[model samples]
Target: MLSIKTFKPYYVKEEGNYIRVVLAFQYFSLLMDDKVYQFVPLESREIRINRETQAIENKDAVFVFQKGKKYNRITLRDLMCVKDFQDHLSKILSPYMILTQPKEKRDEIDYVIMELEKINLLRLIDLALDEKDQIKFNLYTEKLLEIQ
Candidate 1:
């Protein structure tokens, strides 16, 4: 079964042509590839990071979506879509960058591998929604603040 237990929720920023709003929340699927299956509140795609480095022994992160199915271990840097088809897109961030001048344990760690075990810190990117997409976000954020 494709279980919700397999995914992690995260919020992210997204930029669009007409407007911009937070993605509210999204789901990252733990898979052989470091990929995200985003539930975008607006019309945009969300990006997930892979935690494994074995499948990518000599490659970088990637995402693949064709027909109505999503794929992992993709090798592309970017994907584009028009406004009409916006909403709930999948993606992966590859060629993971180790930005530190000095090496760290987190460097070169495969994001896909850790996701399967439930603890991970992959660099997932969220899409900010454009207004006219949802009317309940403000209320949601307020509720979040109450608990925090």
Candidate 2:
């Protein structure tokens, strides 16, 4: 039997008004199961360590969740155990690289990515200013201006 031992999030970040949580899973398959499956966190790569800041900038490193009434009580485990959760995780985790994808599909992904970057930049600018860090605040402002 397949069973989940634990579900832990490695990293969580905010983009605009949404929360993106990156989860690492540990599972097991009992002796009766025909196929054994296991996830050993210590033996594998740290999901966030290999990723760079651009993972957030380009919006591909974590699963995005909107902040609102409906999803308020949901836990990381709840999300992970939901039906078709792997499909949802697959969609979020896939590296939708522009060069490798089909020509026709590239445009849509590129446009969405560019737009997400802009929004993320604006959010960073807001945070910098709020924290009174003139250097980063000014830097983000300049980047946004350049984008315009």
Candidate 3:
């Protein structure tokens, strides 16, 4: 689709990946990079990733929860795997780029990634397999990813 509404400068998205966005796609109308940008809206997706290895969880969600750098996870049971909310996570997560410092000669990119994740709530909340809101939570994660 059309990029953003306006042409903004460049921001380092991933470690070496930089994005020169026209409008910042965030959760709100926050002026990202000194220019206005709207987030892609909040949606969830069951991101498959291993917490310990920080890799995609390739096994099955049925196994016991292994403690690691896990994001909010829920077992997919039914159609409620993905849902939408007005409180799109982008609302809380879009400001992460502000924390990213220009790639320095002495700094490693990995450090910035870990630090930036602090701004995302999905990176925090955790629900047990049998938690009351497990289904709802999984669906939330799925929806968020779809939007992202």
Estimate, for each residue in 1-148, the C-alpha lDDT of model 2 and write its tens digit.
3233333445555444334544543322111134333333333212331132223332232222222221112233443455454454445444432224567798998888889989999999889988999999989989988877
What TM-score quantifies how close candidate 1 is to the native fold? 0.16
Give, for candidate 1, the lowest lDDT window spanning 10 residues.
119-128
Q: How many clashes (backbone atoms < 3 Å, residues ≥3 apart in a chain or on different chains) does model 1 have?
A: 15
- Please list the residue runs of candidate 3 whose C-alpha ends up more than 4 Å from where it truly belongs after superposition: 1-101, 104-128
Residue 27, model 2, lDDT? 27
Task: Output the number of the lDDT-best candidate.
Answer: 2
TM-score of each: 0.16, 0.31, 0.16
1 or 3: which has the higher lDDT? Answer: 3
C-alpha RMSD of each candidate structure in angstroms: 25.0, 18.2, 27.2
Off by over 4 Å in 1: 1-5, 18-27, 31-148
Each prediction's Cα lDDT score?
0.31, 0.47, 0.33
Which TM-score value belongs to model 3? 0.16
Superposition TM-score, candidate 2 onto the true structure: 0.31
